[model samples]
Target: MSRSAGRSARSEDSAPSDPDARSNGPRIGSDISSNFPDGGQASAGGASLDRAGAKDAPAATIASDSRSNPRNSDPRDILLDALRAALDAVGGYRSVHRRLMQEASIEGPCAAFAVGKASAFMMAGALDALGDRIEKGLVITRHGYAAEVIEPGWPVEVVESSHPLPDASSIEAGRALIDFLRRLPPRTTLLAMISGGASALVERLAAGFGAEDLARVNRYLLGSGYPIGTINRVRKRISLIKAGRLANFIASQEVLNLLISDVPGDDPKVIGSGLLIPHTAADIDTGEIDLPPWLTTMARSAPDLPPAKTMDSIRSEIIARPADARAAAAACLRKAGFDIIEHPEILQGDAVEAGSRIGRMIALAAPATVHLWVGETTVRLPPHPGRGGRCQSLALAAAREIAGKTGAYLLAAGTDGSDGPGEVAGALVDAGSIDRGQSAAPGSCPDRSLRAADAGTWLEACGDLVRTGPTGTNVMDLIIALRARSPASTERSFHAG
Candidate 1:
C-alpha cells in the first residue's frame, strides 16, 4: 500500500465553509489569531490557545479562586499551565502569522513547504494569512503530530514520518519535497516553515548512501549523547538536501524562511540541519567533534561536494525560540505570586547530573520559589538501554534527591509533547515519587532503573509521568521546580493528572 494511501488530495474550492462542522479527517478553521492580540504580543500570564485555537483560562488563574491562593493549588497544574502559556507564546501559528504579516509586499502565487513537528499548525497559519496567495503547499511532520490543522480538502499534501530517526517514509517525503520544489513555476515566492525534527522527518541521502546507513549514523549520534548541534553537523555532511542544498532547487526565487528554533543559539544554520542555510568550513569541521571510528569511516567514505553558496534571495528569521518559552513560563509563575529564579544560560551535559544539581538547588531554595530552566540535555545510552528520554532520566535522578522531602516538586518535559521513544511527554516528580514507585512495584529498584535509563517505567509505576501527546511545538525542554511556603504542611502524594 502507498504510504499516503488514506489521504486524498483536494482543491481549496472544495473546503467547507465551516471546517469544524465536519466529522471526517482532522478539522481546520480555528481562529488562532485570538491567542495573540495586538499582532502576536501576548498578555502577561494570559490565556493560551489550544491546538484548535480555543482560548484557555490564564494558567495563573487556574491555581486560585482569584489570584491570592496559588500556593494551595497543585504543582502539576501550575507547571502544566506554565507550559501551556509558554507554548502559546511561541506557537507556530502565531510565529508564522506574525512573520507573514510583516512581509505584506510579497504577493500571491506562493508555494509553502512546512517541515517539522509544528508543520501542520504553521501551515494553518500560512493558509489563514496567505489564503489564495498560496497556490500550493506541502506539510511534512512526525507521525501523530498532524492534529486538527490539516483537512481533506486543502491545497497541500501532508506526509507523516518518523522522528529522531529516519525510516523509509522519510526518504519518500524527501523525494516528494524535492519534486514539489522543482515543479514550482518561475517567479513564485517560496515560504519555508521550518522547526525542530525536520532533520529526521525528511532526508535525501547523497550518492552511495542508503536508508540503513542514514539510520545507523543517526542512531550512533543520538546514543553517543552528542549535542543536537553536533548531530546536525554530522547529518549535513552526508545529505543531499540539508546544509542549504535545498536552495539549489529554488532557481533564484525569493524565499522566506521562518524558523521556530529548537537549538541552543537559535542558529538557522543548525536548526533542522540548515535545510536552506549554507554551511561554512567551520560548520562542517568534525576534527573537534570526537567522532567514533565507524562514523569517521562513514564520513570519509561519503562523496565530497563543492562548497555551499550563500543565497541573497533567501531571507530567514527566527520566529520563536527556547528563550521565548522560558520567559512565558516565568511570567506566568511570577503572576501567580511565586518568586522566580530564572536561569538564562542553556543547560547541557548529563541528564542525571543536571537533575541532581537542580534537586539540591530546590532543596535549598527559599519558600514559594519557582526555579525555571530551559535547554536540551543529553543521555548516553548503554549497549542495551531501557526506555526513557533525557527528561525522564533527569526527573528520576532528581526523585532520589527529594525522595522523602516535603513541599517540593519538579516537572521535566519536552515542549514538543513526546519524549524519546514513548507517547508520554515526561514526568512530574514530588517528594514521595520514589516511595510511590517502590510501592507500585515492590520488587523493582529505582536505582537499577535509573542506571539502565528506564526512568519512564519507574515514573509510570509511580503515577508521575506527564503525557501530552504532540503539543504542536518544539522548543527544547522545560524544567520547573516549585517549593511551597510551609514544608511541614505541604506533604502531598504524587499526582499524575
Candidate 2:
C-alpha cells in the first residue's frame, strides 16, 4: 500500500491538540519494527494517542518521567501499545504484498475482485501476485478505493457507494453484479473479494423498501437509536436476495471467495449481506416485528423475497477475523509483562445491558490487570437522534458505573477500522475518562442519566475517539484491555477474590 494512504496521523483537524494538562512525554523515534513476534499471521505496526503539552511519538509515546528515554510500565501505555499492535495485526495490505508474483511464481489467480475502503491497494497486490490470471475483475467499491488497481486490461468495474448507509449507487451496483453473474461462463472460476461496504456498494433495495424508504428508515433508526441487529433483522425481511441469495447464482460454477469481514462476529451472512453464502434459508416469518409507520406500511405491502437468490456453489475462506486481532494484541501485551485474562469473543445482548455487565465485571473481578473480549453485539437503536457509534454508546453506558475506579481501560474497536459511519473505530474508557468527560463537556457529557443519543456527542467532545484509517480487514471488534486498582494491592477489599 502507498505510504500516502497509510494511517499517517490521527486527524486532529476535527479537533486540535490540547495544550495544558498534558503529560511531559518525549517523542519516540521511528524504526519501530513493523514485524510481529508471530511467524506470519497478521501485519503489524505501532502508534500513539493525542495528549496536550507532550511530544507525540510517531512510533510509540509514553509519559516520560525521564526526558531522554520514555518506556514507563504504566498499564495505559501497555494497553495502547497493544491496541496499535492489534490494529496492525489484521492489516489487509501485507496479504496483498505477500501474494506478489516473483520470478519463480508459476501461476496466478483465475479471478479476483477486491472492494471497500482498502480494496484498491489490496486488490492491486492480488493482481500483482496473480499477474495475467486476474482477468475479469469485479471491483464494486467506493470512489477513492478504485485507485489501487490501474492494470489496463483488467476489467475494473468501478462503482461509487455509501457506507453505514445504502443509497442508489448500491442498488445500481447490485444490478450490475447480477448482470455480470448472468453473463459469466458456466464453467468460469470466480474469485469474489468481499469486504465491508459491499452491501452498500452493490445492493438491491429490499422488496417494498426502495432507496427512499431505506434512507428514511435509516434516518429514523439513527434518531431512535436502534441496535444494528434489529435493523438487519427488519432488513432481512424486505430484500429479495440478501440473506445468501446472491451466492445462489453460480450454483454450478466454483467461487473461491476471499472475504474481509466487516460485520460484527464476522458472520458471512452479515458481511456484504452474504453475497456468496447463506447463513440460513430466508424466511419472512422470522423478520416480522413492530416497526415504524413507514416500514410497517411497506412490510404490509411488499413481496417477501430478497432482491437476490442464494447460491450453494461459492466456497469461502475467512482470512481475517476478530480472533486474529485479539490474539495478536494479547501476544503484544504479554511481551510487555502484563497479567491478562482472556475473554470470550462472542459477547451479545442489548447495548445498555451489556455495558452494565461489563462495568460490574471490571469493578468486581480484581484478578487480572487486563481483560479481553472479541465478539460483536447488537445496539438496537431507538427512535431518537444521538451522536455516537456502538463503541461510544457502550463506553458511556459502562462509564456510568465504572467511572473513577482507577486503572480500568476499555477498548471497543471494530475489526474493520471503522465504527458506524464515523472515522473512529472505537474508544478507550479509562477510570479518568468519565469524570474527565464530565469536566471536559460538563452537562454535555453523557452520564448514567443519558437519553442514549447524548452518549455519541459526549465521545466526540472529550477527544476519546480511537480512529484507525481503513485497516483493510473486517472481523467484528475487540473489547480488550482491563486496568484497575490491583486486588493484590488491596489487602481486604470485597472485590478481591
Q: Please report the candidate that would top TM-score against the real structure.
A: 1
Give Cα-based local distance difference scores for all models: 0.72, 0.56
Provide the TM-score for each candidate, comma-separated: 0.80, 0.68
lDDT of 1: 0.72
For model 1, the stretches where C-alpha displacement exceeds 4 angstroms are 1-72, 216-231, 285-310, 487-497
Worst 10 residues of 1 by lDDT: 25-34
lDDT of 1 by residue, 402-427 (tens): 87778778988888777788787788
lDDT of 2 by residue, 57-159 (tens): 2122222222122433455445556766665555554344342322232243355666565565456445434545655666666654443233333455666
Candidate 1 clashing pairs?
none
